[model samples]
Target: MLLPQPRESIQDNQKGKVFFVALFTVCFFIMHYGIFVFVQTSMFFAVSSIYRGDLFNLSIPALK
Candidate 1:
C-alpha cells in the first residue's frame, strides 16, 4: 500500500477488466474458428461418418 494512491475510480477498474476480458475472448474465438476449419477441411480424425451424420457431403449427387 502506498501513502499516496494514483487517481483511479471503481468504474475505471471495472472498465479495464471488462475490456481485457472481451479482448481475450475475441482472440480465443478467432483461434478456435481457425483450428476448427483446419480440422474439418484437412483431417479425417472424425469417427462419425459425414454421410452417416446426415449433414453435408460433397460426394452425394444433386438433382437438377
Candidate 2:
C-alpha cells in the first residue's frame, strides 16, 4: 500500500540521519582527544572554546 511505502521511506530517512549523527559524534570525540594529546593544553583549550562557544579560552600550559 502507499501508506506502507511512505512509512518505510520515513524510517529509512530517520535511520540515515541517526547513522550520520553517530558517525560524526565518534569522529568529533576522536579528533578532540587527538588534539589534546598532540598539542599543548593552552592551544587545545583555545580551539575547543571556539568550537564550544565558551566564554574565554583557558590557556594553562603548566597543567601539561
Q: 7 in model 2: Cα distance from truth in Å?
A: 15
Q: What would the TM-scores of all predictions be?
A: 0.49, 0.43
lDDT string for model 1 (1-64, tens) is 6463344644665778767988999999999999998788544524443333333544433331
- In candidate 2, what are the lDDT values of residues 1-64, reduced to their tens digit? 4343344455765888767988999999999998877567556666755344343653444554
> For model 2, what is the error of residue 19's alpha carbon versus the real structure, in angstroms, after optimal superposition?
0.2
Q: Model 2, stretches more than 4 Å misplaced? A: 1-10, 40-64
Off by over 4 Å in 1: 1-10, 44-64
Residue pairs in clash, model 2: none
By summed lDDT, which 10 consecutive residues of candidate 2 come out lowest? 50-59
Model 1, TM vs. native: 0.49
